[model samples]
Target: MDAQPDPVGEPAGSLDPRAELSEFLRTRRARLKPEDVGLPDFGRHRRVPGLRREELSQLAGVSVAYYTRLEQGNGRNVSAEVLDSIARALRLTDAEHAHLTHLAKPKLKKKQSGACAQQQQPVRPALRGLLDTMDSVPAYVSGWRTEILAWNRMAAAVFGDWGELPPQERNWARLVFLRPDYRDLFIDWEQKAIDIVCMLRMNAGRCSDDPRLASLVGELSVKSEDFRRLWATHDVKEKSFGVKRLHHPLVGDLSLQYESFRLTDGTEQALVTYHAEAGSQSEESLRLLASWGTDASRAGSSVRRTA
Candidate 1:
């Protein structure tokens, strides 16, 4: 990451993902004071902490001036040597180290939509087949980026709102935070939003360099202040399986447990299916919802596509 700062903006259309990742890492590091990490926080009234450029330089075993240049994105040749030392000084976990390495590496300049980029949206045929077969349960396939690729009839019933939403707003995660109807649909709106935001943040980190992901982030950041704030926290958690409580307009309050499995052969989409404990009142409610969703799907059939 060594080079003089490009004026105005990236000579290309936008800022490099490396630039964004670097900024995030620097901000996160600078936010922590020495005392926050058990070192003395005695600088009285200073700028930032955890480590100053000089301190980080010492801890990372690199020269202060050189580190500064790297931070400034002027160090065009930041080898693995510097990154490894920096990770050690930051007490980074394995995942963090991997993310750091990703940030420092050269951009994958291949076209964002191509044979290699197939994983970006190539929903597996097998997963799609599974979704169709699971017409009895609320099931759908979505990629990490929260795209509603494909869903069974039952999926539409439980998440009926998605069926009504235009293509631009079919995102369950975004609706959970910004849509008025969605906020009121869940009895525990606050918790639901938090979980969705956390999951979305995790996906964003996993696909930070993706053009579609960048667009999604920009849209959500502009549309919801809550989304913007949650995103800044940098929390990452995969939400594959969980129990959710929702007050469906048609089926009343119901609890459903969902499980997600990543598809290996087809696309990078995850197949998520929601089920209720057999013989329980919640299960009965889910069945009713399933029936209603099936009826609706018949009236307005649309194929779900996942990438």
Candidate 2:
């Protein structure tokens, strides 16, 4: 009748859902203004940046003490009705509401035998072939943890030679936080870094027990001040479609739109493809980059055969 020990070196602790909920609520509350939420300004100087606890409780039709407890992470059995009312008072978007619910009720961690027990599934040959066929676009496959599982030649040309890195170093978040070259590559580096952290925070909720993810987060937190600051904001975001601006060393500035699709093959993988608008300067730059990549690949192959 004793509790079992957690898997080896998997960290001595798991994520604290209540703490996450508290931080998220605080940040969201701080971002709202009295006038923005249809509350009257009494012309009195305010100490806080956003609505007061009493003001929020009044708007949500809840008692100040109860809302205070919720904000303090002590509302153990918050009902759906109360949550909905709070969401409405906060004027949360659909994504924000879902994220609030997740923070309030995080998924339970799964028991794993060991750190290496959960091996990454191999990318399907068909998917790899599909990537290769996208000669004009940059594409790659990523796992649930945002690690690059597979990438095409165009992806390498556009995003640097990912194949040169070890598998553990090929992660998107890792490249964003740990590599100066990647930071220099993006024109909107600050926004991109924040978005990457938000996506990682969202994934951390679902995979709190994954050692690889935990390690990545810890490393970033310790190494990058920006990562630490953004991570504390408790933002959550899903990576879907978005526009990115990159300043490739070989091709100058380019604007690319990316789409992400979940794979059907049950491995919880996603295929992300990046493309430029037709007949645009970015499209021409992409073509030039792809040609350079192709020539470089062939030269490397020839050298390997000579060796």
Indicate the residue-level lDDT of 58 in model 2: 96
lDDT of each: 0.62, 0.75
Q: Candidate 1 lDDT, tens digit per residue, 1-307?
A: 0111111112213235456465646765776667655566555776554467776777788898888777775535788888899878777766566555544553432322122233345455666677778756888776655667677777776665354555556566667766676776678887777777766654444555555656666777888888888777654455668888876666578788889887664444567788998998888877665666556443322322210
- Count of clashes in candidate 1: 11
Model 2: per-residue lDDT, tens digit, 84-199?
99999998877677677656654322321122225457788888889888888899988766778888888877776666666667778878888777787789999899888877
RMSD of 2: 6.8
Q: Which stretches of candidate 2 lie over 4 Å from their true place?
A: 1-12, 107-120, 209-211, 264-266, 294-307
Best by lDDT: 2
